[model samples]
Target chain A: MKRNVVSLTIAVLFLTLAVTGVMGFFLPFNILTVSVHALLGFVFIGSIALHLKNNFRQLKNYFTSKTALLVILCVAALVAVILLQPKPVLAILGLSKNLGPAADRFELKDTKMIYNYTPAPHYKMQLNFKGGRAFDAEKPPRVAIWLENTSRYHLKTLYHSKAPDAQQMLPYWHYKKSEYEKYKAESEAAEKAGKKQSEDVDALSSATPNESFDPADYIVPKDPEKETPYRLLIEINAPDDGNEHYPDQPSLVYVVEVDNKHPRSYQVLDLVGYPKSEMDEEEGEIEWSLLYADGTITTAHDLFDSALLLIERSDPIK
Target chain B: MKRHFFVISLLMLISVWVFFAIKAGEEKTSYQSFQGNIFGTRYQVQYHAHEQLDMDAAEIQAQVEKLLQRIDKIASTWKANSEISRYNRAVAKDEFQLSDELREIITLSEQLKTSTGGAFDIHHQGEEIDVSAIAKGYAVDRIAEYLHDELAIQNFLVEIGGEVKARGHNAKAEPWKVAIYIPPSHSHIVGPRVTLSNTSIATSGLYFRENHIKNAETGHAPDHDLLSCSVIHPSNTTADALATALYVMGAEAGLAWADQNEVEAIFIKSDGSIIKSVQAQR
Candidate 1:
């Protein structure tokens, strides 16, 4: 009776282990499958021990026989092959990983898109442009927002209307952008030739001129700071609404100077000037001379009823 | 005496087998972790293997980053030159051609919008389509697939921002467990926990920030009593969109929608009450 019980226990445990192992292999990783397989495997060892003890004499006869030696040799060979981690065996195991439900495949490719990876700014600059009576949704006016240093050097473009004729619509911004690009190209060429570039070009290439102007590094100096105020500019132009000033009305530029050290809650932009329509023949560039809005400026001034530049400062002093 | 020797030898063999088995289980317990930043948010991936992993941890992380970068290039609205941005800026909306990836995402978004009764919409304020709500979740699903299909990583967890997808068992040979955090306040109080195996969980709410989620019809942030809503699904993209939609739906309507759709979800009310959908009760 004891031998029968031991034999039956081995058979039952072996059946459970086999079932759980197969389930664990086929099914997605789950606690039940793994725990049952691992825990029952230990129990199976105990049952096998009992079975061996119950039939020691029969097992001894079988072990010394040629059949037992052959079985042992076969088991050893299988273990050796698996331990070697051959490519074919690994590939088979890899296939088992995908035995679960199929995943959604994305045929993604590199889109060579140019992305601006600028660091998050300390102050949030929200530009609120209210469309005036002249502002038409059908023929929306092209607008460009950019930042410049106190000395009128172009710093960066905050926003630009994605119109094909954006350059013609915002000539003032286009001229500044062209100037910046030329400087940037010259600096790059000089750097490639291992030549010491001009100090102005080097300053232009850096994110900001002075260390204090670095928005990311908010290091408060003990002494009263001599901070440089940056100018925010916006250029707006309406197409096909030509006024008496020119066939295609020149773009209007708005300017606001902001001091980082002495931050303000709100700063209204002042109507600055429009870039001269004619290009300078000698310089091969659009003349920097700006024309003030006059009687002919008419509907172009009404493109934006009001422009508010709200700045939220993250400084401790503020 | 020979019989005793044979029995002892058999016992020794059993002992060796048990020892090796225990060692293998131990090996599975020690997991390798990889973490990085993507989509202006942090992400983490944890996985384990019974045998040697085919790729190094760094190499796998690089591949994951590359995959995320590609997705960002296609879908990120912040990128001025991205495919989605181009579509948004296009004068003729109908004429604008979308890439296969963007088209698929937009189709999924449209289906979600219909299913949720316009509570979830990517088209915002005429001609603008923002997939910010579902893009992260889609990215999470993509990474999970990459790990499973490309690397053959069976046991892994991928989390980007608050969106998460887990598969198989963890290093401890147990189902992956994730915690859902409630918003507004009360850090000490543990909200809820979800056991994920081949599933995802996404939570959306106005927590520690200004209200960014707006009603699709009204074009303004919805006035609601619920603080946060979390959804669990096999696909992280679906879970993500549902979370945002449920938040807009509030607790009552959200619960009803979740039950009808058989979506497992948990909603935390403003007055510190928790509500679970019928499926989530499990």
Candidate 2:
């Protein structure tokens, strides 16, 4: 009975360790995976320890003769395998020592981590609400509160995912994909006929670029059904006089109106959502909600363009 | 009989020790590489060592190259005889059969696209979201699997482009030293150092790639005001995709998304300002 119980315990412990170790892959960001893996590791160690203790007499007998040779060989093989394991793990994870193991082993203590990668100052800004009635239909449908680049250089285009209701297809999105084929055909015909149709086509295509930026370039589906969020593509250029930061900025700023009933025209100076001190600008995307009369709150491109949109939008190459 | 058995066992131990000791002495370094062709790009794997367990350099490189070629054959925009090329050209619209590589990348991309709200879209046309940025990391992972599972490699580092992964310690018993190239303006690689081990790191800023993050879908400066974005993730694919997406998204949304996802990222705004993830500093 004791022998059977011991076997059952050994089997249970082995099963538990294996199951926990395998579960580690899916629960990568989850802390429980680590805990489970650690627990399993302890169980494995304990199992081996107890088993070795129980087999002490057999181990002694084996060591006295050829059995010892086989045991040593098995251990050597296991060691080789263990030693060989790390390379594949690193490769599979695309991990290197440069990134440091602590990143995976631990999480950042505080959520307010920051760094100084760039050489310039910034006007970090944020508003107080979530994505609320910010997308209410107003004269100009509201987006997150933002500022205008009135900085010196010519304006450039900007792109981002907007709110669900606020999402509007740019004029370009109206064109059926067949339009590209038609344009391509004309251009090709012009090339074959030795005419200036190519230039004309290029001119037509480049027409809206200098004046209006289209948001279709950064289109992303809200769902597989094809609904998408609002995005604005801006185009601006600054002369490269060897400046590190561009003087030109987004000529336009679209802020989500706070009033669900009457979203107001959002302007930078009127944007009191973020603390004045944090309202510095370099060039990046940031989410800003309005505390307007409407109280329309929304997340600004919470995903793709969120980071870029997290900072102020700038046009110049800077 | 007992004495004979003892003598044989001792000899066996000595032989095992001699073989391993010699191997250990000869094993100075190991590396991992990926070689494959996808989207007209040829990828190759090389240099992963696991203390002399099934070390075959040429074969691993060949396998990686073969996988790359296979991907090229299936990628819808792979330029030539590649499957993607036909799909993009509208010639073989029905030929959009997804291969294993395509399916894997697409699945990963779709997951990221939804999670990041299209910030890291793999299906993005115009500059076409090439998985190249993240493929290296995947290749590293694959190489690791091949070595550990197939060949039993234990200690090594793998990298392609600027992304990297490493395991175990170097000859001096130190973690692998991966060097990050400073922005072109800087004279050396001294600034903005991030030390890592047993993890993957990737940078998707225009610092490299000839600043090619323009929006082909809109003929506009896609990365307006954003210089670069580097993301580090437990998964290299996530890091790579996020890096590119965040760079394309520019600064604001990049930082915002980083904050939201609890991801460690660093963004360089167009004006040369850097915004780092709260997680990265820690």
Candidate 3:
């Protein structure tokens, strides 16, 4: 009886040590998980081997009775795995994931070795090219201060070695300090007043006027300086400004930009209608609306100031 | 007996573990940097800086330097006694005995002139066949090829002036983006993100190198309506030649020529409007 009691105590202690070792690891107060596991494993192996050796006949009968249960459990688990993991079969047929429209993955390539990249920065600018709805066709162009950077800094760090050195870097510009104060009233005057993102990409590297940050927006000009490479971007404004005067609405409009390789004056090359279904065959023409710094408004056929280009992919894909 | 055996085994195991723990602390990676002269310019080359030195970089640089010196010797009109000077004095009299590099430029120039229909040409003026406009592009391509093939560099970017060739993904797997500056004020970018890879992009702008873009057959230098024109091609030399040609031809014929030749291009009209080749837009 004393031997039985000692064995029972030892088995209980062994199980307790195994559970404790598995649950606890690396804490200052419980750092002996590995050591405990090692000792318990040694004890468990010896004790189990001896117990089975003493009960060999009973162990054989127990396994024979549990065979059907073990087989059923394995089959059920296999079925569950098959149902949940249909991707392998779908992929085999090449019919797996069909990411919807605007699901393109952009792949950029380095273009440094082909040019005689002087110890001077090259410019590639992307800007906003805005457009008005069909109800407002006669808005004409504006003498807008477009945003542009002379610095040819890339967004990716991996290409830093290939990028032009600081001596050869281009120039950059940012949005106005009081752009909201200057344009808020004018924007409110529009029939469907909307939020406008700042056009200054330099704003990203520099400190903002306020904590306010939003993407830039532009309306297409009747004539965009054509001799330069300019990109464009557009931001949609909410009607009420949503309690915040310059809220960045969830929606976006259009993007504009020119290639920075050749910087020159601005002109509009082509324009396309919004929403393909509602697109009119106007030969991609746009009337510009000028909202300038001096509060006075006059529209024209072209727009080219500090900014010239912008680029963006369609939603999800972007 | 069992207690003695356990103590002996424990001591042996601890000694082996202590030895391994001490040895692991000594492992580390080594690095090195290299520098040299090539094409009459100095190059500071940095690599993983392993113990194994690359003989190819030194050999290739030497080869390139000699080629440049030879080209300089022949291309200068002032060196009346040299091969290039004599050729410049009377290009019609002699089919010049040229080196392999010079021959490649000559053939490429003629081929581009024929195919892009004058949008890519190296002129034979008076006595010299001037491939000056396209030289940098070719240099970049050749140097890049040497680095990739001979030296086995997988991720590298090389530039010759404004022309550039890039290969391999960025360390972060992002495509390499190039920026181009607007001319007149060549300090600012007309746009910021121009993406390219494994190929070359060259831009010719009115902001630099006056009178180099005159009409070849007529020599009539029209007022440039293009602030800049860039051609993206399989090679830097082709892009360089194409950029010059497109700038001379303007948007109308230049685009048609690009399409017919199947090279990608972007032309910036003097008014700041841009026209991109279908391939580039794609």
RMSD of candidate 2 to true structure, Å: 26.9
lDDT of 2 by residue, A4-42 (tens): 665677788778767765555433334675677687677
- What DockQ does each prediction reach against the true complex? 0.01, 0.02, 0.01
Candidate 3 wrong stretches, greater than 4 Å? A1-318, B1-83, B90-95, B124-127, B171-173, B184-189
**Candidate number that wins on TM-score, 1 or 2:** 1
Tens-place lDDT per residue, model 3, A9-81, is: 5679687775765454223223366567667777767766666676678877876787857977999987885
What CAPRI-style quality would you assign to candidate 2? incorrect
| Candidate 1 residue lDDT tens string, B92-205 | 989888888789899999999999999999998686999988988999999999999877889889888778889998766788877665431443334666778999888887
lDDT of each: 0.71, 0.44, 0.45
Candidate 1 residue pairs in backbone clash? none
Candidate 3 lDDT score at position A68: 58
- Model 3 chain A: ten consecutive residues of lowest lDDT: A202-211
How does model 1 score on DockQ? 0.01
Compared with the true structure, what per-residue lDDT tens digits does model 2 show for residues B103-193? 6876787787788776565545543445554555565566556655676665555554555555565455666554333343333222244
Task: Look at candidate 1 and tell me the lDDT of residue A101.
Answer: 21
Candidate numbers, best lDDT first, in rank order: 1, 3, 2
